[model samples]
Target: MPIGDINVPIVGKNVVIAVLVQSHILFAAFIIGAVLIAATSEYMGMVTKQPRYERFARNLARFVVLLFASGAALAITFVLALVTLFPVFFSYLQNIFFWVFLVEAFMFLGQIIIVYAWYNVWDKLAYRKNLHVVFGFIAGFFGLMAMTMIDAVASYMLTPAEAPATDVARTFLNQTMVPLNMHRFVGNFGYAGFLIAGWAGFRYLKSTREDDRAYYDWMGHWGIIWGFGFTMLQPVIGYGYMKGIRESAPDAFDRIMLDNAFTFNLLMIWLTVLAVAATGYFVHKLRFSVRPMPFLRKLAIGGLAFTALFSVLNLIPADGHIATGITFLGGEETQIPLGGMYPWKYIGLIGLMLVGFFVVALYLRASASGFHWGNASRWSQFALIACSVTIVFTMVTMGYTRESARRVDNDPGYLIYKCITLDQKVVSENCPAVSDGVNTISGREAG
Candidate 1:
């Protein structure tokens, strides 16, 4: 039975919707994690009477709040996209995770109210500062819980356990559920922490007052410290996630990772080194707090040196080992594995983004005199615009990846059965009598 029987839409409407929904995900994450962290820090400072921490927290929280508003709005748009584009998927998901999504919605509303109150009463609620602080934490906690609930559904979709055939709820609560949510939570913090540090550094560069600049420098150091800590923890979480996937749905995980055996290994190797290097450099830069940490420069260089080395390794051919077990692009769709091992360019794209972040951080710290409005030094503006674009585009790609990976017409064990295969001979035998894959030709019922 060939799958050419069903007239599925070209490019698949589900894929488009998934991309839109996924793209909105990162923004929601920004609001929930980084912004929440900063907000909590502000409240903590207020209660402790730590003016230095309080000031940093205040400014950082403001920035995070602005970003969070945009993120929250886009998250609503994501839900809309889900209904508009992937109607079938939306239905299945709602039915499967009905209670979870409903709870998430309530949590979102609670978070919003908390955010509004927390921000508005910064001064008004000064008398009972502890109460206000608790409000912000409430929002942050609910937001985190909502995200965690949703992750179970996402993970279930990727790793649909055999249990679903018996009990759908059991399938939704599979092995990947817990680890994936935790992995993603830490990832959000790690990415956001770095941005906050860069923001602090930019402030330091902009201010003329020595004390103000010093305060910003210290804040920037703190941000990096948080980022570095999370960065280290990220790998552990990821390993657990991958391990869960391997244990539960080895085939799907293998299709994505093992098929790109060399590229995946090489990238992992370099990123491991990069994470360690970044952590060491981050600590060194903080220890001195003078100007770029001259003594610790070697460690930064060493870290990057390894990053570059692995970048080259990633470009190497893995044909020696995983050749027959990999996939490729732009070639004949021969045997599924034998073509090649290229898991698209998404991973390398992430690497490029990290490089861009560092470059922008450098420019942000450079003096205003160094900036030329026009004819010279345009890269700074370019980096900023690029960063913004990357955020949006990456969101879209993630959505697309989620749906596209479903492989509606691929192997068995998954029920993305939108397309139905038909037997041409059987069709020829009975023409208009057939009713898709469930029924037979000659107006007879299929068993």
Candidate 2:
């Protein structure tokens, strides 16, 4: 039976598939980032002889081990939903990416085994700390390999290589592949870090014991450092990613950067929230620093001011047209001042990165000197929570912006951007003539 002939109920097939995939992505991305962070923490514990680091690493590894099953289950369900709802599209994708899928599956299996082994042998290999740390790193490596394999497929869908699809190397190394991979690789760390910070903040608030409060307070500080540090690198990487999209898929780029600019603006708003909240946390925490450096605090406050200023610049729209049915200033679309992507937005992004670096540097200096951990204000903890919540919305908005770019003007759109239609039809002359030695349409040996 034709895959298109199968119709989903009132909610629609696209919505069902989207929900499953997005949910699965949230889990998968977290696991990948968490594994790396756990491994790093364990190594730090070994070198610094810090029990807190060890405790955090052990708990995180255990959490990853427990969470693995849920992530895997959701991944399987997403695949099943995709195959059932979009069989033809899935079939074509599978044919082109068979080896990639095979490699990803093995990587996933290897990650699971190593992660469990690493967690289970925590005490058994206490004497052999170096070897146990290697196991954790190995698990992280496997997860990253799996992520890389999947990224090739995702990037290709947006900016497919001009070469024949059967050209495996070219297909895998599509224009956007490396940038997309780097973006996600960095994003995972930031996302996981913010969540950890938020969790620690909540625990700190709930704890009655001084020791517990101190531990959670330190954890929150450590987590936010990782989160904010990695997030600073994203703007440049994301710009390169978007540049590739513009060069390869102009129509999609126009849809995202111009026609549907609101989504991109929303993304910037979330980013602004992240910067402001994280910087605010840093500035507040500096006030409780053991050494009491008023100069550093003032610097951080200045950095926060500049960060907010630049973020407002980024939030400005290129034009008054916000959405399909929306317009600003008396329902007439018009160009807005200081809103162009070239000079204004680029300047804003650079400014944000610079200010972010300055603030982080100041915060880290205070960290090296140490802070009165349990004495952090409630408002600072709330700032961490705000960052965590904003990051979730940022991820969702990013995904939506990227995918919606392909659906310009509510069109059926191409699943593979001009190569394969959403209905699973091959629409491009550049598409492979045959798949698995059979004609794609006729299902017979290619003449």
Candidate 3:
């Protein structure tokens, strides 16, 4: 059978792969972050003796166990699709990343074992709380290791190292690998946290019992702390990742940042919504704080205002041209003021991070004093739901932007940057050649 021979009807091959991969990522990322959060919660429960913390940890652990199978299935489907649609490219990738794949598989197996063991022995280990918490941490560690292994492959696809493909260390430690790993590392927590908060908010609204309401309210508060706290670091880490991309693969960077700038703009808008909505939620919740801290509430309001202002600045388009190559003003490219990435966007991003830190600090301080749980206004809960929804869109937009950067003027481009084309041909000096069932690199047969 010839490679790249299979194609789906109507929707095409790329869309199928994209959908499967993206869906799998959403699940996989959530699982990684959720396990870590559950572990931390369990430990805090043991130390602080808060029954609510223990309850949340056990419930979340159950959810993670249930969700694992779906994520794994999607991942398997994605691999099968890739092999079918891009066989030659997959072959090349396999030869180069065999060790990485092996490590990832083992890590995944370890995670499954430990996570189930962690959940199943919850009652048996109640007396041994320390050991139980260790199991959860180990499971989370395994999951993170798996994610790290995969990140190497994903990052290499975008920014292949200058060294030979056989140089495993160089290939795995590509230019963008570290920043990309950090971005996703922080992002998983933010993504999972917001979803948790959203779920808790919905449950809080529906709960009829006072105890259930209180628990759900507390859960919502805890989830938002993780979500917003991690999210505040994204802009900085994301910038470092982008800088690596721009330096290593300028063409790909321009494709997303300039040619298809609308996607980037959309990302900014989603991020802005995340920041403003979260800050507003904190401010609103402050009104019901157990202690009278009117000063902090007023400061939070100001923080929210500045966050919105910075977000608007970030959302401004650099030019009138949209993704379709159409200029809105119908002239020689109309440039929008306060839109350039240099001074204005940088200012916006930096200002956002600073103000986010200030706002989050105030919120945490007030949280230490405590809040009147189960008494939150409906609007505040709705804000949490809004943040959750925006985070979903943000994730989708980011995936699309990064992947679509490989597309050159709406045409299928390289699968592994300059090395492998989308149609499965190896096109670079660094790529190996297959001759008569033997792999040859630079005229020397590979072992």
Candidate 4:
């Protein structure tokens, strides 16, 4: 078994799949995130009798409707590419997880129907706003289930259940499945929020009307609140997901975390960027307060300095021995890289997060005292735009890391962990009628 012997020379096949899958996930994530925001806004509108929240919700729902078809098309193309390029791998996954696929399909269908219906009848259902809100929840619920089903299947491919029998339930409940689901669930909100904020920021910049500027500015603020808030949960939840990977596939975990230093370092850079962007948004929101807050300003500035330093250190290659004294969380002690190669990233990541937390806390304290949303600087909006770009880049890097981790051994990647491997062999041609000790078919080697 030579390396790549079983793989067909389909040039750019992986890239094609990557682009389609990432695009599909991006669109789908936006829909999920929008649904959440719309639901929340509408509920608050109803409770507070605020027309602005109601209008915002309607606009977002309309936006979701516009993107629905494109998202679906991307999903269809992704599946087609998978089947055409890697039939064996696709079939293997389909056979083992058909039930999950079935559920996902139904949920996806439900989402389409529900989302469109909710969007189309927005004005008609104005009198029955409560019912409309319920429909929104229903649509979100369907979307969540669809996402969960797909995530479980993806997670199973990375860390298959530790069972000999091919029980569908057991396979679906793999160790990493739930954690991945949680991470993605949180990520959906964050990604969606940032994108919305970025759009609002752009609109704010373009608007000539003062009212329009105010509206977009407020909308951007609302989006950032959800975007940054949900993002904060990801580090903790992602740690759990990585722990599952470590437990289920120690080698794969090491390959992602320790062996591939650069990619993990890139992750650190993205995390630092996100930390800075998020904290910067916080500082911007409070920078113009009537009262002086010298302590908080200094804290935020220190955070930026550390983040910038971490980003610089992340650029250093991992082959050489780096100096280290001690490591601690949320301060300076650097170790426990989360799928990262460099040790200092551990410090950078934790410290950045701590700074973000304090920045958020200080903002809350300021809000309680006297800070108002009167007018945020355009520079602050630009910071949010930067956050959106970095978040998207971070997500793409994560996808690349996850996919690359599977093939770290430089052998044929596994379709189901140790049992079914991927390669170039055509299954129909190579499979034998009677089984020998070792069997090779469809690029899969089973014994």
Q: Which residue pairs clash in candidate 2? A: none
Which candidate number maximizes lDDT?
Answer: 3
* Residue pairs of candidate 3 with colliding backbone atoms: none
Model 4, span 169-278: residue lDDT tens: 77788789999999999999988988888888888888888778778877877788788777867767877998898877776787786555457667767776766777
Judged by whole-model lDDT over C-alpha atoms, candidate 1 comes out at: 0.53
lDDT per residue as tens, model 2, 1-447: 764667688998888877887888889888999999999999999999989999999999889888889999999998988888788788888988999999999999999999999999999999999999999999999999999999999998888766656878988888899999999999999999999999898898899999999999999998998899999999999999999998878888889987877888898999999999999999999988989899999999999999999999999887767777888774335778898888999999999999999999999998887888798888888889889888889888898888777675556587777667777777534444234353232111111
Candidate 2 shows a clash count of 0
Each candidate: RMSD: 10.0, 3.5, 3.3, 6.4
List TM-scores for all candidates, in order: 0.66, 0.95, 0.95, 0.83
lDDT of predicted model 2:
0.87
The model with the greater TM-score, 2 or 4, is 2
Where model 3 places Cα greater than 4 Å from the true spot, the runs are 410-412, 430-447
lDDT of 4 at 183: 93
Clash count (model 4, backbone only) = 8
lDDT of 3 at 107: 99
**Model 3 residue 322 lDDT?**
65
Model 4: lDDT equals: 0.74
lDDT of 2 at 133: 96
